[model samples]
Target: MIVADGIIELDNKNKAQGSGTAGSVLVLLSTYDSRVNDNNAIHLKNDGNSGVIYAGNGKIEVGNGNQIKEATGWKIKLKENTTVTYGQGMAGLFFTGPGGSYSLVKGTYQAK
Candidate 1:
């Protein structure tokens, strides 16, 4: 999982490869915009693997020759020649229940 508070800019020829038996899952979480500039900018996949990119409150722009499994954002722009294969069993992984809540872990925080 790649989490960013701001923009995530991926240059040309960048790869976020994954490996495993359950296949691989690459999760890109950003609070701001994520961009892939130029052709061949990113390759977010491994054979038969599942990859997911999520931009919480921002947009995602991908360049040509890029490959991915799935992507979700406020706005998504894809250049020519980009490839995306939506894999199976991916729906359950990103499900958010209604009224979900979070609580802080006890004793994990330290005062500065």
Candidate 2:
């Protein structure tokens, strides 16, 4: 899905699945004030299949300011057989944000 210049609040959990055994979540944010916050309270889970989540933006001020932009309260759980892929051009997924905490419950990770 696309969030051009707005707010995407994932209150509980957000999910996406593919046709068979593969699926993906692609987020593209333009050079506007677009933000995605999970309140550092939810788990974005990709389970029982092959899936990828790619969120990219020219400007993502994660943890540079307010609580909404901070990754201090972020939680991402990749169950078995799931992967969160990151590209050389992408920035947010590779960094440890505020709270400076990340726990890998399960699954495999790679660079693409």
Candidate 3:
């Protein structure tokens, strides 16, 4: 449960009349041993400037060239047969129960 929060900028051509949306994004991620939950939180740079990789609650094993997050939620990393429950933010529940990556078996999206 890695909490990553920061702002992003959209640099489009002048032809576009409407401006882009920019704000803080809180991203929660975790991975195992490349078999179950194996991998980095995020490895890509498309459209983002500054942010923080909040790894406080749980143990955070990061890769190279990582950013600084706000560090809040727990950095959870479960192994084989490990089950995790996902809760809500401040309103409706997004994810709950075991699984990995993006999975929606019972017709419900486990919040990202």
Candidate 3, position 8, lDDT:
17
Tens-place lDDT per residue, model 2, 1-112, is 3433433333223333333323233442332322343232222332321122223332232221112211222233333433344433333354654555455645655433
For model 3, the superposed segments whose C-alpha errors exceed 4 Å read 1-20, 29-57, 73-112
What are the lDDT scores of the predictions, listed in order? Answer: 0.61, 0.31, 0.30
RMSD of every prediction: 6.8, 14.1, 13.3
- Per-residue CA lDDT of model 3 for 43-72, tens digit only, reads 323223223332333343333222323323
State candidate 3's TM-score.
0.23
lDDT (10s digit) by residue, model 1, range 1-112: 8777766666666666455556677777776633443222122322322367787556776776677778877667777777787766566446523544344467874222
- Residue-pair clashes per prediction, in order, are 0, 1, 11
Using lDDT as the measure, name the better of candidate 2 and candidate 3: 2
Candidate 3 lDDT score at position 55: 31
Deviation (Å) of 97 in candidate 2? 25
Best by lDDT: 1
Which model scores highest in TM-score? Answer: 1
- TM-scores for every predicted model: 0.65, 0.26, 0.23
Tell me how far the alpha carbon of residue 92 in candidate 3 is from the true structure, in angstroms, after superposition.
Answer: 19
TM-score of 1: 0.65
Order by TM-score, highest first = 1, 2, 3
